[model samples]
Target: MSTKLALLPYAAPARYSRDERLRITRLAGALRLALNIHPGNGLVMVLGHGGEKNNLEALETWVQRSLEAQALPPNRASLQPLLAQLETYLTHWEADK
Candidate 1:
């Protein structure tokens, strides 16, 4: 018998749901360690290739909302600025639409 590991597609989108919220938290934590971004220092924001602000905002909202709903503890000192950014993005999203 041979054991094998299949790498998930990098471009695959995360499915949003209650269960997935836990997954996202883990994903963020892994990213923090992998990118060397300590919560105390700063948060990492990865802009996708050819990504526009609108699309970015939408993605941000998806992640932020899940975090808030789950009351996920901040790995950093604070998450206020990140929350504020998402709020601002939503405001403009409605105005632009």
Candidate 2:
């Protein structure tokens, strides 16, 4: 005779925590950044309505803080591209000024 083991149903991974969500919301608010969570596209859109250099810097700082504080939840890899785009935009914007 053999012993039998039970199997459990698998569940989807958590994409974000409540605390992290709130933190992201607050940061976006403070930076005047608009966020669009598109489930269809699976993207957290950060629409920046142009601001001063310091404001962009602040956004970058906040993002870094989120990573450091372990506030980045699932699909966190997406943030890297966003940050890179932000930096590039800021650089060109500054250059144009």
Candidate 3:
């Protein structure tokens, strides 16, 4: 006789750990490997603002440090599109309240 596993109740989305976030960021980066503001880049900014109020300055600082440490150049020209994407993400963040 065939038996089925017990059904489990639905649960909320699992919270991501630091490593999980990093992994996700890396994967995102890979998908947009050519972009100036890829997932790897956004990951830092996203983490800083996670579950907290929006802090543009803090997000900017985190992005700057992450890029600088990696020896990436300071080029806002390449960053504009990414900035726009971030703004959109931030809008959704605010709406979650």
Candidate 4:
């Protein structure tokens, strides 16, 4: 028997200030570099098989540590969109399982 899965509703693209957009662009570049340099390592391993909850927790912890290391304020508004994207990805991944 075949099973049909319900599709998730579309989400509107997030709006960002110029500074926030720059930050997001830089972050994406960094992630691409890391993945290219160390395929199947570190964060990839954590997010790969750790399940959704653990993946989110690990991502949050990494974000916190990165902010601390950079001496940045604890304001996470700029990252909310990125987090939301990750959450949506995780939800879809779980459904596929």
RMSD list, candidates in order: 15.5, 17.3, 15.2, 12.2
Q: Give TM-scores for every candidate, taking all chains together and pairing residue i with residue i.
A: 0.29, 0.31, 0.31, 0.31
Segments in model 2 whose C-alpha atoms lie over 4 Å from true places:
1-20, 23-75
State the lDDT of candidate 3 residue by residue for 1-97, as single tens digits.
Answer: 3333221233343455677445434433432343334333334434353432333333544444444344444443435444444455555554553
lDDT of 3: 0.41
Candidate 2 local Cα displacement, residue 17, angstroms: 8.2
Candidate 4 lDDT for residue 76: 43
lDDT of 4 by residue, 1-97 (tens): 3334432232333454677545644554443343342333444333433332443343433443444444444344535544454455545655666
Looking at model 3, report the run of 10 residues with the lowest lDDT sum: 2-11
lDDT of each: 0.41, 0.41, 0.41, 0.43
State each candidate's clash count: 0, 0, 0, 0
Q: Highest lDDT among the candidates is held by which one?
A: 4
What RMSD value applies to candidate 4? 12.2
lDDT of 2 at 24: 55
The stretch of ten residues in a row with the least summed lDDT in candidate 2 is 41-50
lDDT of 1 by residue, 21-94 (tens): 55555544543444344344212223222342443333443444445545554333224444454455444544
Candidate number that wins on TM-score, 1 or 3: 3
lDDT of 2 by residue, 1-97 (tens): 3333221122232355677656555554433343332223111222221232444434534454444445454234646554554455444544544
